[model samples]
Target: MTEQPSAAAHAKTQADFAANLASVRERIARAELEAGRTPGSVRLLPVTKTVPSDRLRLAIAAGVEWLGENKVQEALQKSEELADLPHLKYSVIGHLQTNKAKYVARFAHEFQALDNLRQAQALQRRLEAEERTLDVFVQVNTSGEESKFGLDPDDTVAFVKQLPAFDRLQVKGLMTLAIFSTDQIAVRRCFQKLSALRDSVREINPDIKELSMGMSGDFELAIAEGATVVRVGQGIFGARALPDSHYWPGFAH
Candidate 1:
């Protein structure tokens, strides 16, 4: 079993969380201003994937209102564990299986990685049954990476056109995971691609405005490229024990 930290250690952990959250917000503000966008235009979604509930609670206490989890089971577990913290909301940011739509329908406030009609239909049925509505972002594979789970950019327009049939699932915007790389130019290209796609889609559906892109490493570039939501994990939660390859196969560290 894992040994629990002492009281001092727990206190230090909370302190670190607050400090990290502040630093990230500061960087976001700077990035937005540098890009000539309003400072608060982009939202920082702290990803709690792989983070334990105890630490997650500390993060919530440290002013994190919404937590993004990459797995349905994990997010459900955390929601149950942190049920008392009613102010906290959850967003499932991973590729969701159709079979797991019920779990998200029952609890998740938003689903950020929506890609296909099958998954949307599954979620719509469950959400309708449960009398719950969920905010959804159409995931676009802007990097054109096969490993990523998102609809092709070319297919997004047609896909969004079909979403209105699923009344329970509200199509709010688009989401993407940029190619993980050290080369800033290459990374920015992915964000730019998504932004451009969003712009094109907006011509038909004005409500589809949010662009969920970027993560701990390249969020600044994402912000400059018009990301409205950046799913930052490592920057706020410290580092994950597993490498990025564990989540994104062939992801360069």
Candidate 2:
């Protein structure tokens, strides 16, 4: 039989994790404050994509309540296993498939990447069928990448105008993925565009209040451009374990 960790070893492990979380929270505060924004304005969502449920429980014990997952299947499994933890908030941060809308909406507190009207409508229908309301963020392709999945600036406005049709789905402003480059100017431009798009949406509907942008690399720039919710993964969890060659999983790039 395998030997379990001794009580002292477990206590030491927990202490190390607690210290790490406190440091991460402090870093977030510093980053937000550097941009002339209050520390509380930025909410830290530990992106526990491939991490197992045991790690998730450890995180919750260390004071992480909000978590982001990129795949519906992964999130679904973790949700079932971690259902006993009432304080945890799991959000779908991936490119959601239309057919998986019902499962995604079943647990996601916020869906941060609605790219088209079709997807939005599908989500609405699913929510109505399930008799639930979902918070959604319309993603914009600010980087103008052909590989990305978001509305063009013009199309995003039109999508916002049609949001009233999806009464059960709450339109919670915009989410964007900036071009993956280190050029500060380029990053700022993309973020600025998303912020402007958000402004336009708010003009049309006063209730749209979230701007879910930024990741580990460019989150500070995103904050400067008005990202109220930042989805940071590696910055919090450190480098992820490299996957095997044959595993062509949904989010395994």
What are the Cα lDDT values of the candidates?
A: 0.83, 0.76
Error of 2 at 7 (Å): 29
Give the least accurate 10-residue stretch of model 2, judged by summed lDDT: 1-10
Provide TM-scores for the models: 0.90, 0.88
Alpha-carbon lDDT of model 1: 0.83
The weakest ten consecutive residues by lDDT in model 1 span 1-10
- Best candidate per TM-score, number? 1
What lDDT tens digits, residue by residue, belong to model 2 across residues 1-253? 1121111111124455576566656666776787788769887777777766776677678777887988887788778888998777878878888988888768778788888777887888888887889888888999999998888988888878888988887887788899988687898899999988888888899888788887776777788878888776665555666533323265574
For model 2, what is the alpha-carbon lDDT of residue 47?
77
lDDT of 2 at 65: 83
All-Cα superposition RMSD per candidate = 6.7, 7.1
Steric clash pairs (candidate 1): none
State, as a TM-score between 0 and 1, how close model 2 is to the true structure. Answer: 0.88
Model 1 / residue 201 / CA error / Å: 1.3
